[model samples]
Target: MSSAPAFRKFHLMRQRWSQLLFAHWPIDPALLRPYLPARLELDLFEGQAWLGVVPFTMSHIRPLGLPAVPGLNRLHELNVRTYARLDGVPGVWFLSLDATQPLGVWAARTLFHLPYLHARISLTQTGDTLRATAERTHRGAAPATFVASWTPGDVLPPAQPGSLQHFLTERYILYTAGANLQQAVRGTALWRGRLFHAPWALRQAMLTEWDSTLVESHGLPTPTGPPLLYAADALDVWVQELRRI
Candidate 1:
């Protein structure tokens, strides 16, 4: 894959993502196929698919040229995602995103057509360790909770094109659908949002603690063994408006 794509035209939102943890596990392609829309294909590495559960803190969220709103500017977010490709462009396909701010959830669902849910979440730092927790509170939605603690380690070199680290962390586009696969096949619109950020400052991470059912809540099996872990300091991002594919 080429380096992270750039989108300098215009952006609708700006935010800082900090103290992030990327935890991923391999899964069978057949199991994840049914969850994706017809217009997008499951992106795989060496014929194997993977699922990721990311927990991070969002700060300085605001519309372009506007100041950050007091209560909406900061929040904790956790997301369950998988890799996808549409017309040869790789992007993230989110199954569910749970955030602490209800307004943020509503805006994401309505404006971006992403599957966003309201949740109770918190993040704390103790010395060199970071702790995160999230519980999905959306009424009638599948119950999910995540609790994890990690310590950042030495910084690593940048991920190369063919590496798994690059595949999982370097994605710059996100694909979402307003309808299910059946509707997509019937000509429903699929949306793709582009994001621009500096190359990830990756670091080795030690997952000191983890107990999560976020993936299983979506009807998939709980991940087995330890996950592939990585951490990053922070990055300022610019998100362009969602476009129809």
Candidate 2:
């Protein structure tokens, strides 16, 4: 019998507003330093349903978007988003705005339609490698499942012909129930290729539409393809290696 609760929650609060505003910021340590949260928590879920919470904060006047939202002209803002998982799947997310300000509770209940947060995770360990299966569900319906396979290896190494890229994972796929969605974005990326690549500014501008084409081909409705979900920051190189688990 499974005794674990069904959901994990993380509450993100903001101290200083982040300057970057555009969505889908690549996972970069330096660029994300300004917005990195100070503290957060993860709670255990139990029973027919499960709940978890994490608390963190952000800054005002983020660099990437519209002007900061001001309420009572306070220097800091406090809020929390709860995650709830049911049936071992991603369930719902509820956001509580203005925890520190007056009427914050009323605003959270009336203005936004925040739902309970949830997610289902399964892990398998094979020798030195681990495989994680993450599923997202809405109501009783499952949205998508992301399977990640990881193992300890060098960050950057030379690429050989017909070899897999080491900087990225073996593969990332989406699934629904037991059926493969077939709507998966698969590609081989080598960050450290000895190729003439543009600087960050030029690369960002030129590769803006790369995601759109890549994801759309896989039956996804992404106006822009999903951004590169890098695991580490400022990783400018790729390696090629595959070891048995």
Give the candidate number with the greatest TM-score. Answer: 1
Q: What TM-score fits each model? A: 0.93, 0.22
Q: Count steric clashes of candidate 1.
A: 0
For model 2, what is the error of residue 127's alpha carbon versus the real structure, in angstroms, after optimal superposition? Answer: 2.6
Give the per-residue lDDT digits (tens) of candidate 1, residues 176-221: 8852323433455789999888889999999989999899988999
Write model 2 residue lDDT over 1-245, tens digit each, in one string: 11211211111121232111111312222322221122211112222111111111232321112344666322222222222222332222222122233333333223322222233434444774444443333234224444444343333334332332221222111111111111111212101101111111111111111211211222333333343221211111111211111
Candidate lDDT scores, in order, read 0.87, 0.24
Error of 2 at 66 (Å): 35
Lowest-scoring 10 consecutive residues by lDDT in candidate 2?
A: 176-185
Question: What does each candidate score in C-alpha RMSD?
Answer: 3.4, 22.3
